[model samples]
Target: MNEKLKKKSAKMTKKDGYKNIPSVDELMSMKQSGILIEKFGRKLVLYAARELQSIMRSNANTNTKDISSSINSLEEIVNKYVLKDKTIINGTGVIIHTNLGRVPLSSESIKSINSVNSSYTDLEFNINTGKRGERHKLLNAYLNILTGSEASYAVNNNASAIMLAIKDIVGKGEILISRGELVEIGGGFRIPEVIQASGAKLIEVGTTNKTYIRDYENAITKKTKAILKVHSSNFSLKGFTSMPTKKEISLLAKKHNIISIEDLGSGLLIDTKKMNLPNEPTIQDSIKSGIDIVTFSGDKLLGGPQAGIIIGREKLIHKISKNPMARAQRLDKSALSALTTTLKHYIEDEHLIKIPVWQMINMREKEIKKRVDAIIEEIPNNVRRVKGTSKIGGGTMPEAELPTWLLSIKIPNINTEELLKNLRDLPKPIIGRINDNNALIDIRTIPVEFDKYIIQSLNKLNKKYK
Candidate 1:
C-alpha cells in the first residue's frame, strides 16, 4: 500500500477503536508460484479485498486465507447455460398477451401435451391403418365438431396457415385484398408482406378507411386467384366507413372462380358476448358464411397453444395438405395433443369458464370488485379504489379498454412511475398502471398466488413512504 493510504487506513481503524488491520498479503494464503494469481490476477485480488471490506464494514474478522478457496469453489460450480423458450406468468391483463405467451393451456391440455411428448406412438406412423396417414387427421374430427367445418388442418401459427393456402393455391396469380384490411400486427407481421412472401401478386382494392364490395369486384381480373378479407382486430374505423361483409366477398370470389379466405385474428371458440366484448365472427360462423377457407389463431381468443388452424371445405384443405411447404408448417405431436384437448373443451360450451383466459376475459365487474374488496381488506388505509381502465391487450381488442376496478395507492417516497417499475421487478412481476401520481393495480389480472405477495408489497411500500 502507498504511504498516505496506509496511514489513512490505520488512522480510520484506530478511530473506530480497532487494535489492528492486517496487510493484504497477510490476509491471503502464501503464494505458491502465483499460478492462480497469474490466471486471474485482478479478479482474485478484488474478490479478496471485497471480502475483507465486508468483514471490516460489519466489524467481523476472517482469516483472509479462505478468499482464494471461495473463488475456486465458485469457479468449480460454473457450467454452460442455455436459454430455453418456456412458460411465463402473464401479469398483463391482455388475456392473450402475445409477448408473454399467447395463452395458458388448460390442465387437461397440459396433461395431453405431457403424455404425447413423453412417448410417441404416431406423429406420422398410422397405428390403425398401418400405413402413411395424415397427421392432421388426429385433430380433424375435434375441429370439425367445434367449427362445423367439413375438414381441418393446423400449422405453427396463423401466418403459416395463410401462407400454406395461398402459396399452394394462388401460385403465379394475383390475390385481391382490401387496403383497409391490410393491418399490421404485433412484432411487425403485416398482410402485404405475407402475401408477397407467398409468391402471389398483391392486388389492393378499396380505400384505407372504406372499402366496398364494388371495389373488390372492380379489382377482379383473369389473373385473380383468391380473395382475402382480414379482420382489423387491432383497430376499428368508426363513422363514415363501410366495408363488405363475408357474404359479399364470397359472392365476388365465386363469380370469379376464386376462393375466399377470411382470417379472423382473434378467433374465439365460444361466444364471449355475455362478457360485454364486441361480437366477432366465431370459427363456426365464418364457415357458415359461404367462405371457401377460414384461418385463425388458436392462442388469441381460443386460449390454446400457438397454432394456425385452417377449417373449411375439404377440397381446399386437401390441396393445402399436399403442398411442399406443408411439411415445414405442420404441427408436432405435442401441438396436436394440446390443441385437440383445447378444442374439445368448446364442445360443451359451459366448460369455457374452466379455461384461465376465458375466465379472465369473462370476469364480471362484480367479481373484479370483489377481488378489489378482498385486496383492500389486507392493504392499509393508504390504498383505495380509484376508477381506472384495464385492457384486453395482445392486439386482440385494440379498441377495447375493459372497465376495470383499480386499487390505487398514493405514496410520497417513490415517484409513481418508479413505484410501478419496482413492482414489475418483483420475483413474479406485478404490472399496473400509473395515473395522476397513483399506482393502480387492476385486480382483474392478478393471479391467486400473488394476492398475499401484493399485500406484503403494498405494506412495504407504505412503510417506505411513511
Candidate 2:
C-alpha cells in the first residue's frame, strides 16, 4: 500500500471507519458513478448509493477499499432493483411455470397486444355505433363458442371471478362445499377464505377423501344459496378417494333450487387425454353438465394472458356482472386483446402449433433429444444428454410428467450451487435444476430461439469456472 493510504488504514477505528465511508455525493462524482447515472438515472443512482451507505454504516468496518469498488457495489444494488422483473430463460422444464410468468404468450398474442396497446382502437367504445360500450363484450362471443356457454364474463383472475360469483349469488347466505374441495391454491389463497371474504358462510360437507352427492344435498337448508365444486387442480387424491360426478352435483343443486358453481381452476379447452396426459376436466364438459356458473384461469391450460373467465347461464353471468366488484376486477384492453387472439388460435385448431404451452407439451422426445445433443456439442463444458421428465406445472395436472431429454453439466472446480448461481448471473440468466450434484437443463420449456443463450452461458461458465 502507499505510505499515505497505510497511515489512513492504521488510524481507522470502528467509529472512524464509519465516518470514512464515502458520501453519496462523493461517490456520485466518480467516473463509474456517471455510467450508473446514465443507465439508471440520477434519482435511482442516488438512492442506491445512500442504501449502500446505510448498509456500510451498520457494520463496524465501514472503510471501503476504494471509491471504484464502492461504486461497483452500488451498481449491483441498482441492477437488482432495476431488473427485478426482467425476463429470463426457463430451463426448468416446467411448462406454465408460475414463478417464471405462467404461460408465455404466443407470437400472435404478442402481436395483438402490441397492436392494440401501441395506439387505440376501441377498448370501451363501440366503433360501429360510435358510443360507449362494455369491454367484456369483446370476449363474450369467443368464449361462448369455445366453451359452449350461454354467456361469459372475465375478471382479473380466477380468484376474482370466484369471489364475484360467490359475493353476488350467496350474499349473507350459506355456501356448501365438499370438505375435499376446500383447496388452497398457489400463494396460500384458500377457498374457505374466499367464501368468507365474499360475505357468505362456508359449510364444508362430507369427508376429505369421500364427498358424495348426498353429503352436499344433506347440507342444504333455508340459508343455502349455492353449492361450490372446486377442482383439485394442484393436487390429486389417489387410492380410496371418491367424489360425486359433475352431473350428479348439478342435478342435486338444481333439485334444491340453489346455484351450481364449479371452479375449474385450470380451464382446459382441448382434450388433454389425446396428448397422452392425464384426463383433466374441460370447461366445455362442465358447462355441458349443467353447471350454472363455471370459473377458471385463462393463463393455465388456456395458454392465454392472465385472466379469470366466468362462463355459464346468461342470467347468472349478467347478475354477477352487475355487482360493483365486477368493475374493480375487470380485465384491461391488452389482456382482452391477447386472450381473444389466443382463443382464435384454438377456434382455428392451431393451439398445438401457435401456443407455447401446448407446443412444449406436444414436443416429441426425439426432437428434444436432438436439441439437447446440439447444445452439448456447442458448449465446451462436461455435459451429456440424459433422460428427464418435464412437468405440467401452474396447478394443472400436478402428477403428470412428460418424457424429455436434458443436458447434465458438471464443472470440475465449482459445486452445484455455485454453478447454478454463475448461470443465473449471466446477462440473460439460465434457470435450471440440479440432480445428483450436477446441473440439469431441460429445453422442453425453453424456446428454440433461446438455445443460443444456453450455449453462450455454459461456454462462459466453462471458461471462467473450469
Candidate 3:
C-alpha cells in the first residue's frame, strides 16, 4: 500500500528511547482529558493499540518504540470517542425523550434494580414448585391485571413485540396492515419492514390519507393471518384523513378468524385525553377495543425501563413466549424490577404528578414561569427572559404545545454553537438551544431542582469568556 494512501498518523514514536507506552496508571493520571464513555474508554485504547501494532508489523523500519507511540495515539483517539455517550437527558420538554433515552425510572425502581443487580434470585426458578420456571411469569400477572388480558409477557421493545407476534402467528402467511398505518420510527423502525422481517408477506391495505373498513375486508384472502394497527406515535396526519378505528378492525379480524394486533408504539396506562394530550389509545382501551394482541413500549409513556409489553389471549402469549426469539429478546431482571415499581405507581390518584417524568409533563405555564424565574435569578444580570417552545416528546402528542419560558444569555466573542457544545461537554451536561444569538435555556423542560446548578454552570461559562 502507498504510504500516503493510508490514513496518516498524527505522530510516531522514536525508534528507541527512554520513554515507551505509558502504563494504565500513567494514562489515567495524565492531564490530557478527552471523552469518557462507559467501558469503551480503556477497552478501545487496548483494542486500537493492538491493531496499530499489527499494522506496523508488516512495515520495514518498524520498531518497538514506534509501536508504543502508535498505541498512545490510539489510546488518545479512543478517549475522544468514549466519553459518556448521549445519555438519558430530561430536557427538550419531552418527558419520554426517545433519542435521549426514554423513561427515567423511579426511586423505587432504582431500588429494585439495585436489589436485583446485587444478586440473582429466582429469575427463572419457580420458588413454590422447586423447579425451573418461566422468567415472564413474574411480570405477566401484573400486566394482565392492568390490561385485563388473559395473559401478558414482555420483549425488548415495541418493534420486537410485533416481530415476535408475527413470527409466532403469521409465519408463511400474509400480515395485513393499513397502508396509512404503515409507519416509520427512529433508526428506520418501520412497520412494513418489520412485517417483511417476520417471515411473513406484507399485505398493505387502505390509502395513506383515507381508507375505509371495506378496503381492508376487500384485501383479506386465504393467505392472511394477522391484521396490524400501528399508531403514528411520532407524527400526526392532519386534514382530510380518515382511518378505521381499532374497534372496527377488531370486529373484522374476529369475523375472518385472523389475529389482530395494535402496535401502540408509545402505549400509555392512563387516559391522558383529558389533559389534551392527543388520544393515543391506552393498553386497557386497546384490549377493550377487542384486539387479541396489543404491543406497546414500556419506556416511552409508561415512565419505566425500556421493554415491550405484550398483552393478549394467554394461548397466543404462550406461543409467543415459547418462541426461541422470545428468549433472546426477554427483559433482564433489573428491567423487570424497574417496570414493576413504575407500574405500581399507577394505582394512585396523583401517580402522574408524583413521578418525575409525568410531573414535568403536567407542569403548567405558571409553574414553568416560576421555575424559569428561579433559573434566571441564579444567572448573571445580562441574561434575558424570552418565551420559548417545548414539545411533548416520545411522539405522543404531535400537536400538544407545552407552554414554556426561556432564559436567553448573550455571550460576546464566543460563537453560540461553540458555547452550547462546551456546555454539553460539562459533567452532567446541560442541554439547551441557541436562538437569536442567545443560548436559550427553556425552564419548562428543566426541573425546579436544577435551577441552582443551571445558574452555577452559566456563572462558570460566563467567567471563561471574561
Q: What is each predicted model's overall lDDT from 0 to 1?
A: 0.76, 0.90, 0.76
TM-scores of all predicted structures? 0.79, 0.93, 0.84
lDDT of 3 by residue, 309-384 (tens): 8899889988999999998998888888888777777754555765667777777888787777777777765677
The runs of at least 3 residues in candidate 3 whose Cα sits more than 4 Å from the true structure, single-residue gaps closed, are 1-75, 81-90, 126-134
Sequence-dependent TM-score of model 3: 0.84
Best by TM-score: 2
lDDT tens string, model 1, 1-466?
9999998876676545332444345444435314445655645554654465445546533334344444443333221122234433344455666766766778899998888778865767788779987666758988888888989889999999988888888997999998888888668989999999999998998898889899988888899999998988888778888899888888888888899988887776676677677776677777888898989888787878888998899998988988879878888888887888877787766555667777777777787887788888998668898666667776776766677687887777678888888786665667776677787777776666667788888888788778
RMSD of 1: 9.7
What C-alpha root-mean-square deviation, in Å, does candidate 3 show against the real structure?
5.6
Consecutive 10-residue window with the lowest summed lDDT within model 1: 74-83
Ranking by TM-score: 2, 3, 1
Better of 1 and 2 by TM-score: 2
Looking at model 2, residue 314 earns an lDDT score of 96
Q: Number of clashing residue pairs in every model? A: 1, 0, 6
Better of 2 and 3 by TM-score: 2
